[model samples]
Target: MIVLGVDPGSRVTGFGLVEKRGNRMACVHAGIIRPEKAACFQEKLHLLFRSLVAIIQEFQPSEMAIEDIFYAKNVKSALKLGHARGALLIAAAHCGVGIFEYTPLEIKKSVVGYGRGTKEQVQYMMKMILGIRGDLHLDATDALAAAVCHLNTASFRAAAHHAGGYAK
Candidate 1:
């Protein structure tokens, strides 16, 4: 199965596509979407939405995973993030891809073995786990980590179902 993970933001969004086969998982693509610097706020949102739609069309992932809304000290920052996330959700829904959300703590724990893992820890784990080569943006790596977490969760659920155990 292919999973698309996203780290949404108004100025810059990160995305990664991870494909799972048998016991192996690989990142097919990972990158950031940075709208032109001179663009207006609305244009940035539109760009994010349009870019993700193209990506979903290209990769055709079966599902998408993202970070859930977390408490923000700045209400304005939180609202902008919500808008960005809304664009991502709309993109996924438009493409008929299933969407799932994981809290930052859950994503960190799943990928770094610590609920409060630092961004560096997640970056390190993303490279080590996915065998990713070269450098990647912290945001991009975080996005890939989300995909890895989902793949792990899905595998566990499937195994439980196979053994007639609780899956959720």
Candidate 2:
């Protein structure tokens, strides 16, 4: 199964794609969508939409896992993040990909075994799990970690189903 994970941001959106086969998972691609700072806000948004749509078309993922917004002290910042996330969701829906949203706490716990794990901890764990030796952007690594968490949980559920079938 191929899962695309997204960390949406107005200025820079991070994306990671991973494919799971049996018990092994490998990264297909991971990068950030950086909109030109010189461009106007509307132009940046158009670029984001176009870039995300192109990625979706090229990868053809079976599902998309996105981070859900957590409470933020800055309402304005939160609103901007909401807009970016909405754009991503809209693109996924248009591409007919199933969408699953996970909270930051869920993602952290799944990846680091602690809901309040530090950013460095999550990044370290992502590198360890994915066997990625090269440098990685923090946001891009986080997005890949989220995808790995989903893959692990989803595969666990599938294994349980198979075990239950044999038990029956």
Best by TM-score: 1
Name the lDDT value of residue 8 in candidate 1.
84
lDDT, candidate 2, 70-156, per-residue tens = 999999989888988888888889899899888889889999999999878888988888788888888887788778878877777
Error of 2 at 19 (Å): 0.9
TM-score of each: 0.97, 0.91
Q: Which segments of model 1 are wrong by more than 4 Å? A: none
Residue 41's lDDT within candidate 1 is: 78
lDDT of each prediction vs. the true structure?
0.92, 0.85
Model 1 TM-score? Answer: 0.97
TM-score of 2: 0.91
